[model samples]
Target: MSAPTPSARVTLAELAAEAGVSLSTISKVLNGRTDVSRTTRAKVEVLLDEHGYQRRGTRTPKSRLLELVFHELESAWALEIIRGVENVASENGLSVVLTESGTRHAPGPEWVEGVIARQPAGVVLVFADLPQDCRRQLESRSIPFAIIDPAGDPAPDVPSVGSANWAGGMMATRHLIDLGHTRIAAITGPADVMCSLARIDGYRTALNAAGLPFDRQLIRYGNFHVDGGRDNALELLRQPNRPTAIFAGSDIQALGVLDAARQLGISVPGDLSIVGYDDLQVARWSSPALTTVHQPLIEMAEEAARMVLMLREGEEPNNLRLDLATSLVVRQSTGPAPDAVRPLAAVG
Candidate 1:
């Protein structure tokens, strides 16, 4: 917001003060985001000449900001991740800037380029990916990054934090098997997602361990969101031999599965037991309460923040990826499989 100062260095806050504009307006101008009004943009441009506000790609020693980007912020679990990052950041006198990339967890090259230009102390990416070129750009600029629960496979050298997804998946399936569920199904996230595949492997391993034949038809690959769960559940439940138990990849999807069962008048626990991953808050609010895997998402977020901070201090973590513990949290949603059920046509 401040006037032009080609040779001077002024913080964004100072520029905003001089231009009498909000910090966001100044940022939009700085990032060339194009959402700002022409009138405000013109005013800000005029002030840019007086104050040297364009930090550009300069790695300022005084910059205490950390950029946190999410692919999508609509999930209930997102709040928990935010709180964890904020807690660590606040204690270390670091501020956080939040960015949301469209529907995917990782933004495109354009967004990555903007972040590189911002030159924050470090960046934390959640449920997203960084292209090799983008990763190189950040490294070339001495910017370190950490990914949490990465939605895709990360480079071998990329720092990341997540849970034991395969083990968690195995645990969920084992529980249903222990309840005497021979006909079981698992609705997992996208097949390409690393975590999703790991979870599917866990499920398959558990079934094999129990001496149960692995039926590929019992597996459904879909999005990790709620609607995907419901639609996938409908397909499975309408089949001639629907599963007596179901394992949902996420709490959000599990909730959708619950809805599908209700729509079909299938009494949960009594007729169809359910299990879900991610012990998000909504799991506790489900009609029968969700039996879920505790993925330790908050802890993962906290570890990611710490890792990025350490990187900024020129510290290399001992490991490329940090994995916290994951365990099952049994609740009312899961029970012993029922002895019999009406035909799929009757429910349909």
Candidate 2:
């Protein structure tokens, strides 16, 4: 028999006949059974794709596991996110399955295959956009997913959780401005990322609102790391008309700014002030505790997990994009700008 039309609900017998396989073999592939040979599975999957096949009555299938995928696990913030998801999982009597897959943008093909095989209740991805094909595969299988997007960029149609990066940036800068700092410099993440751009824009807006002139030379875009902060701070501090305060993209980067100030014999909060973002744990433990913008990472993760679970329950979210509010945490790292400048530290 010829393959059924795309609009028609194709049956296992039709798919098996089209693939020249037994009806049982078709069932195995549909169920993600690994007993089938690789070649046979590929052939079956291609035909299933062409036919828009999906298992009947399996949507919102009963499951007790939630999956959380991360592009990389090296950052300390990962723990906060894990704790958030674990909190939700515990409340719902579900288990969390953590996986490190793909890059910052999208997971690898193998990840989708593994996820399809596992058939999770729902999935939460951190900093990774789901590709269209992978999204289709998951949707066809009736798997719900959400993104915890700290980068502030996600697919328009996807449900995502993020913090108010622009407000965070503005608050950080405003705190410095409130400290009587006129010549303030900002060190943020890479130029291409939306979060970085939003934060910097907030900084500029704050400066303009406070009647402070915006200086292009005072702005530096670097990776969200300690080294990026230190290197950029070094250059900024060396200039004759150096800023008395600096706002960093991340708490880790703030540590580097502290390092750079120490190297230049500049006393933090005495001669210079500093502000950091994310308010990570390290911010509290720094030599001089960081004054920072709290991004509410744990809360954001918790919201994303809740969204995923809601989707699994066949509930539609009122909003596709949820941005949590960011607040400023004042600590010892910032103080009023010095009234009189100290002589420049000697640089070898």
Question: Which candidate should be chosen as best, given TM-score against the real structure?
Answer: 2
In angstroms, give how far residue 290 of model 1 lies from its true place. Answer: 0.3
lDDT (CA) for every model shown? 0.82, 0.88
Model 1 Cα lDDT, one tens digit per residue, 1-348? 233544556677877888899999987765556688878866876655444333455456787888888877886668888888888889889898888874464566556757755768888888555665456556545678899873466766789888898899899999999999999999999888888999889999999999999999989999888898899998888887889999999999999899899888888988899998989988998889999999898888899999998887778898978889899999999998888867754654
Report the lDDT tens digits of candidate 2 across residue range 220-325. Answer: 9999999999999999998888899999999999999999999999999999999999989999999899999998989999999999989888889999899999
State, as a TM-score between 0 and 1, how close model 2 is to the true structure.
0.92
C-alpha lDDT (0 to 100) for residue 90 of candidate 2: 91
lDDT of 1 at 27: 75
